[model samples]
Target: MKIQEIREIIKLVDGSSIDEFSYEYEGVKVKMKKNGLGNAQQPSQTAIQEPQFANAEEMPTTKPAKETELIKPVIEEQTADLPGADSDYHKILSPMVGTFYESPSPDEAAYVQVGTKVTADQIVSIVEAMKLFNEIEAEVDGEIAEILVKDGQLVEYGQPLFLVKAN
Candidate 1:
């Protein structure tokens, strides 16, 4: 669907009593929900649009934005400390949706732990997706301030996985 059509749907949904709306065209999907004062309450509508894939034959053969941007730096003005960590830490976010593992194998030691010094190219964790194990690296020079996810945890794209304090 066109951007104009999507905007129109959002307007219509916002003015009506409907609290939620979802539409799919070909391969594109759109979801909208109303957020209220709290988790249980419903308020103004929110819209989320999926990729614009009209058909299987026209599907893009490139990696999604989330998958290719591993090592992207997340700058936070004020990040809370974890135990013995410093507050001025850069967050390392996941590049794709997958299962997080701390080690190459269960019997081996973790790639890195809290307080472990790390360089830009050091592998910190492995994220498994579609039967492929992807090694996630520390994109900056720092100490492994904190590990945000546990082993085998299901993590989403862009989710924070580690907090690193620059050396």
Candidate 2:
């Protein structure tokens, strides 16, 4: 349909708990999906699937002779020493895309640091999206092994924030 309508759909999908959404109008179609937590997915702004225009008038009459390949190269992994790699650890992934903060306030100490013991419901950090500040909790009981993200850094959904070693 219209670009504004598509934008509104994207905003609705992003804010809701739904992971995927699709809409169709006449000959046009659109599909969208979110990068859920712990998936290590990159954010995409482009439309996932394109519609096949039914009528000849709706489709472009002249087609290009050359076909374009959209192949992405595989990135090689670097061998760097990671903390808590030897022990049983749980990764705290970002629940949503936002600015991560270690402390509740600018002047206050961080909620939890390396080696700090944390309970399941304990607040470990804050992730701010728009004007709302969301408190992130430690979903598992453990000792903080490493902080993956720096304070005030922009974090993506499913990106690792902290590594916690089980008690």
Candidate 3:
């Protein structure tokens, strides 16, 4: 399908009360789902699978199994013990699903480190999505207490990126 058609479908889904939608034509498949907040729907996954079979015999007898186990290793537990664990700390959350970048570039210094004081608008990190790098700001004025995610780590939307001791 054309990009315009896909965009129109997204708009339609977003404005309507539908929670999920799916479409398949030819070899292309598109699936969209809302985040359960009754907000705009996001395209969770889009795939184009074209079967290249010269004859019925060329097709495989069984369908490939989904590798759900491989995804488990990507999620790691955060440190359980830290200084001021009992105290109130603000969490800097990722605004979107993307790769977390500590620095603007490989050779550049990180935007902030543990114990680095930051203001509410200070740029703390970058999240690259769809080739666009979005600078994430420290939403609360505080001292960086812990960096939760490693550089180049894949982050999910609303995932905690940093812990901050509010000033």
Top TM-score hit: 3
Regions of candidate 2 where Cα sits further than 4 Å from its true position: 1-82, 85-87
Candidate 2 clash pair list: 38-158
TM-score of 1: 0.51
**Separate clash counts for every candidate:** 2, 1, 0
Q: What is the Å distance of residue 141 in model 2 from its true position?
A: 0.9
**Model 2 worst lDDT run, 10 consecutive residues:** 66-75
Residue 146 local lDDT, model 1: 81
Better of 2 and 3 by TM-score: 3
Give lDDT tens digits, candidate 3, residues 1-167: 43324544665776777878888666556676655644457543322233344456644553322222212223333334544655579888888767899999999999999999999999999998778999999999989998988999877666778999998
Give candidate 2's error at residue 148 in angstroms.
0.4
Each model's lDDT: 0.72, 0.70, 0.71
Worst 10 residues of 3 by lDDT: 64-73
- Tens-place lDDT per residue, model 1, 1-167, is 44434545665776888888888877777777766646546644454545566676655453232211322322231234444444577778889767899999999999999999999999999998767899999999998888988998766667779999987
Q: Please name the candidate that would achieve the greatest lDDT relative to the true structure.
A: 1
